[model samples]
Target: MDRLLSIEPLSAAAFAPFGEVIAAGAALQRFAINGGTTERLHALARARADDGDVVISLALAQARQFPFEISMLERHPKGSQAFIPLDQRPYIIVVASAPTHQPHAFLATQGEGINFRAGTWHHPLIALQDSSQFLIVDRDGPGNNCDEIALQPSWWLTGIDAG
Candidate 1:
C-alpha cells in the first residue's frame, strides 16, 4: 500500500517546523546593495555546518516521471542544506517533522528556494517540468552527515500546485 500526499504551496511559515523557505518579498530585513543596483534580503536563516566547512556547489536535478512517489527520506545530522534554483523552475519539496516524522509536501513556485534545517528529514532534490539546476550550499567535512530512512508504506504526491 502507498500513502498519498497532496503537495501544497511552499511557504516560510508553513515550513517553519522543518526549515525556512528562501524566497523574496518575505518579511525580512532588506537593504540596498551596490549603491541601489541590487536589493538584499538579509539574515534569512541560519545555514550551519558545524564541524564541517560550508561548501558552495551546483547540482543538476532531473525531473521524475509523473505520479510522483516517495518511498524514502533523508536528513543531514551535521548541517543545514540550502537549494536555490538557477533557472527559476518549480520543484518538489518534501519534509517531515521530527519525533513523528510525519511527511509534508510542498511545491516551490518560480523564483523560490528553500533551506533545510539541520537534521530535517526531507526527500532528495526533486525537480519537476524538466531537469533543473540548483546552487547547493551544504557541509563538507568529516562526519556522518546523512541518514536515510524508508517511509512506511511509501507516499504518492499529486496535483502539486505551485503558487
Candidate 2:
C-alpha cells in the first residue's frame, strides 16, 4: 500500500536537520565585493568529502510525474551532495533522518538549492520542468560512496501544485 507524503516549502529552519538551504537574501550573510560591482553571499553551504576530491558537475534531470512514488532513498556515506538548479525551475527534495527514516518532502523554488549532509537519506532529483538542468557538487573518485535502501511501505509524494 502506498502512503501519502506532503511537500512543504523549503526553508533554512525546516531543512536544518537534513541539510543546509542554499539561497541568498537579507536573511543570510552578505557583503559587497569587486569594488561594489558584486554582492556575495558567504558560505551558503560547504561541500564536504571524507576522502575523495570534491568536484562540480552538471546533471540533466528529466521531469518527474506528479504523485510520484518514492520506493527507495540513497545516501552518500563519505561525502555531501548539493544540487543547484540551472534552469530556474522548481523541484522537489525528499529526505529522511536516520533510525526511523520517516520521509519528508520539500519544494525548492526558483533560485534556491540544497546541500544534503553526508549520510542523509534522500530521493533523487525530482525536477518539475522537462529537461531541467542542475549544477551538482560532490565527491569524485573513491570507495562506494553511495548506498540505497528500499522503503517497505512506499510513499506517494503530493502537493506540487501548492508548491
Best by lDDT: 2
What TM-score, computed on C-alpha atoms, does each candidate reach? 0.92, 0.94
| Candidate 1 lDDT tens digits, 68-89 | 8788899999999999999998
* Tens-place lDDT digits, model 2, residues 43-137: 89989999889999999988888778999999998999999998678899999995256799999987699999999999988898878889999
Q: Which ten residues in a row have the lowest lDDT in candidate 1?
A: 154-163
Q: Show where candidate 1 strays beyond 4 Å.
A: 160-163
lDDT of 2 at 48: 97
Candidate 1 Cα lDDT to native: 0.84
Record all residue pairs in model 1 with backbone atoms less than 3 Å apart, i.e. clashing. Answer: none
Looking at model 1, residue 19 earns an lDDT score of 78
Superposing every Cα of model 2 onto the true structure, what RMSD results?
1.7
What are the Cα lDDT values of the candidates? 0.84, 0.87
